[model samples]
Target: MAGKLDRFEKLINSLSTWLNWVAGVGLVTMLALIVADIIGAKLFKWPIPGGIEMVGFLGVVVATFAIAQTQFLHGHIEVEFVVTKLPKTAQKVISCLTYSLGMALFALLSWQSFEFGRTLQTSGEVSMTQEIPFYPLAYSMGFCCIVVFLVLLVQCIMTMIRAKK
Candidate 1:
């Protein structure tokens, strides 16, 4: 069981790493688009059509896609000052509980995001300027949330095992 969980953790970690790379690329693409738009507007008196819309889409992609990687890296802000004061057993229990709650929250987020994405797809929702479909980005957000949820679930399980020992 531990081995299986470890394998799953590794798989998710790899996916998170790949997603992080994608986020980086998205950020760079967004930056380039904005710069080009600015230059075109100032020098040529012509701005890139839908440039703002594209940057908005890329911003969503970059922000949502990096969540799993950020969680895996423990890069999220955490105030551990109070936790540090707890006894060993109490701390372990609290850690497990916290991870479990996090998993639940992310699970709900993923489910709702997926539902919203489906609605967007069925409604043919799109960005006004670019007509960019919103479903794909929403689905990506859902995917990232689920990945982060799984990561947290694994952490909760590990913490439980450690507490047992």
Candidate 2:
């Protein structure tokens, strides 16, 4: 059981690392697009018609995709003073509870987002300017949220297990 859990933890960490790299690439691409748009508008008196909309879409993608990586890296801010003061066992229990709640919340969010995306896709929704489909982006965000929740849950479980030892 312990070995299995250890493997799970390693898998989660590795997956998160890969996701983070993809997120980094998305961010870089977004930056490049923005710069190109600006240069085109300023120097050439030409603007990308859907540039703003596309960037917004990509921004959502970048942010959502990076969430799991951020949580895995312990990059989320928390007021740990109270938690730190507790006994080791108590802290582990609290951590478990916290992560459980996080999982529930994220699960709910992901479900809702997916439902919304499905509805949008069914209706063929489109943006105001570029007429870009909104469902794909929403779906991606929902998926990322799910992934983040799973990673956090795994981390919490691992922490609890180690605390027992």
Write down the TM-score of every candidate. Answer: 0.96, 0.93
State candidate 1's TM-score: 0.96
lDDT of 2 by residue, 78-130 (tens): 78899999899998898888899899999998999999999999999999899
Cα lDDT of model 1 by residue, 1-165, tens digit: 889988988998999999999999999999999999999999999999999999999999899889989989889998889999989999998898889889989999999999999999999999988898999998999999998998898778888888889
The Cα local distance difference test for each model comes to 0.92, 0.87
Off by over 4 Å in 1: none
Best by TM-score: 1
Clashes in candidate 1: how many?
A: 0
lDDT at residue 96 of model 1 (Cα atoms) = 86
- The CA lDDT at 124 in model 2 is 99
